[model samples]
Target: MNAREVMLTIPVVLAPDDTVAAAVHKASASDLDILPVADATGRFLGAVSKADLVRHAHDPDARVGQLDSADILVCHPDHPLERLDHDPMSSVPHRTVVVVDEHGRLCGMVPWVNWAVDEARTQSGHPRSPMEVRTLSMHLHWRCLDCGYLSARAEGTPVRCPHCGAEQSAFALHTED
Candidate 1:
């Protein structure tokens, strides 16, 4: 299926100017992995996950625009879901995949799954059980050498820099205290 067919149309969004408190308040009322952030003109800026926001909630006055971002999978509405599987470099994305139009305006979101890596498992004759497919994840720290961006994910393997779009080869394991 294409992304459009699997997307959830969300009417609410957070603006970059919104405060961290605002993001936390709004996210508290939603069940999405990453809340969509858009501009006044409706251009997709980035996203803020509830987990990430909660960590930064101490700085209640911080602007959402200034938040550090992790790599998010992005695709056009017409992007075939199966395309992610063919690309071996793709990490198993379990966050929200933002769907944008040609103009980079937010269209909707397709909640990503572990299908990429699961497919690999299937190919290796050890397919994941339904429960195992959604098992607990490890939060890892990854630093992007290209842009010096550091991000942590409790879901899939991080393979790129969220700030600069660097490839997996450009990343190094980072440790956070």
Candidate 2:
């Protein structure tokens, strides 16, 4: 299957001009790890992730430009999603990859977990099959928006944090492993 077929639609996105704090808030509220950065024309610029934002705690003046990686790893909407891992070093450290159309417009964001699954399936010659790596797991640091609690999880969405009655949307998900 191609990226268009497997890629999840672009979730919440933040503009390049948006402050790091705003990105953090939106990400936290949406329970997402990375926030796609776009231009005024909605062009896919780069990505500002939860990690990048947290790094800002040490420096609030940090702009998206400072934390954003201009080297965006993108795949054509028509390109096979399984091809994402064709190059072992193609992907960046923690930033979610952006999917662009022929015109280079931001179409979607492929999280690392989804990308890993696609890559693994392709490598195993079962691109359309379900996950076979039984021990496959990932860890992430999440911030609870409602109660401002910071916690960690292993691959499942966290809802109804103890400190607050908020739902999953009340937390921001950031991959740490």
Candidates in order: C-alpha RMSD to true structure: 11.8, 4.9
What does candidate 1 score on TM? 0.62
lDDT of 1 at 5: 71
* Superposed model 2: Cα runs more than 4 Å off: 58-61, 70-72, 86-95, 113-138, 144-149, 152-170
Per-residue lDDT of candidate 1, residues 1-177 (tens digit)? 677877788766889999987876665445455678899999999987655776786788999999876456788888766564333333533655788999999999865445443454566576456743543224345555445566664433456667888776655443332
34-145, model 2: which lDDT tens digit per residue?
Answer: 6678787778777766656766755545567667463346888776655555443334443355788877788886665355545546666874444323222355666665
Best by lDDT: 1
Q: How many residue pairs clash in each candidate?
A: 0, 0
Cα displacement (angstroms), candidate 1, residue 142, comes to: 26
